[model samples]
Target: MNRAVAHPQQDGQDRPGPTTRLSVNIGEATAQVLQKHKARGISITETVRRACAVYDLIESEAAKGSKIQIVDRDGTTRELLLIP
Candidate 1:
């Protein structure tokens, strides 16, 4: 695996901690989705950060025997299942 250590910089000054630089190869469909987000004024970094936070919440709740569901406007409800 390839890895890079990065120092966070702001206002021409380096921050205190080091961050990891990640390189990923994504499929065409994923790229298209990212492009759509970009058009909506969202950066790829912010999108990934939000997605990670959501996934973390789902996994944490699932571990506690909770069921994830979606409710429609017509009073219809459906359960979402995740397989480990």
Candidate 2:
């Protein structure tokens, strides 16, 4: 399940827009991943935000026929397929 709540400004400061709080339900594997990130001192919200940004970039690049790759310390290269 997913839920979103809009929060209004409180400090009477002029800003861009309202902030929306999001809640989501995840499986055990995903929860474990979040726990790992938490152990690394990363908050769950930051992790999700970064993940969304990365996913957006990958999707945009893939749409342009770009291939993602990973290079190892031994100078080995391999393609990473996240979409399709």
Candidate 3:
């Protein structure tokens, strides 16, 4: 077996910094969405935050089955096929 080095044998100054990580390669359609957001004077960070919130909401909804009752209000039971 062989070992691999995770970092250089140099001081921390040789390591990459945080700003190098804050960049991403967004596609054309994603750029269009960002541009529309910019028209509303929103920063990229805000856009990403909003997107994450919406994603969480959608996933939660899909995970939770609706509480609606298909049976009549006369105390009847109904068969439900949950997409589990």
Model 1: per-residue Cα lDDT over 1-84, one tens digit each: 332222333232233576566689999999998889989987777666566656776787779898777779998999978889
Segments in model 2 whose C-alpha atoms lie over 4 Å from true places: 1-15
Best by lDDT: 2
Write down the lDDT that model 3 would get: 0.57
| lDDT by residue for model 2 (1-84), tens | 232223333343225677568788899999999989989987776677667756776677778887777679998999978747
Each prediction's whole-model lDDT (CA):
0.69, 0.70, 0.57
lDDT of 2: 0.70
Worst 10 residues of 2 by lDDT: 1-10
Local error of candidate 3 at 2, Å?
A: 59
Total clashing pairs in model 2: 0
Specify the highest-TM-score model's number.
Answer: 1
**Per-residue lDDT over 1-84 for candidate 3, one digit per residue giving the tens place of the 0 to 100 score:** 332223322232323664232578999999999989979987666676567655555455546753323466897976544454
TM-scores for all predictions: 0.75, 0.73, 0.48
Per-model C-alpha RMSD? 10.1, 10.0, 16.4
Q: In terms of lDDT, which candidate is stronger, 1 or 3?
A: 1
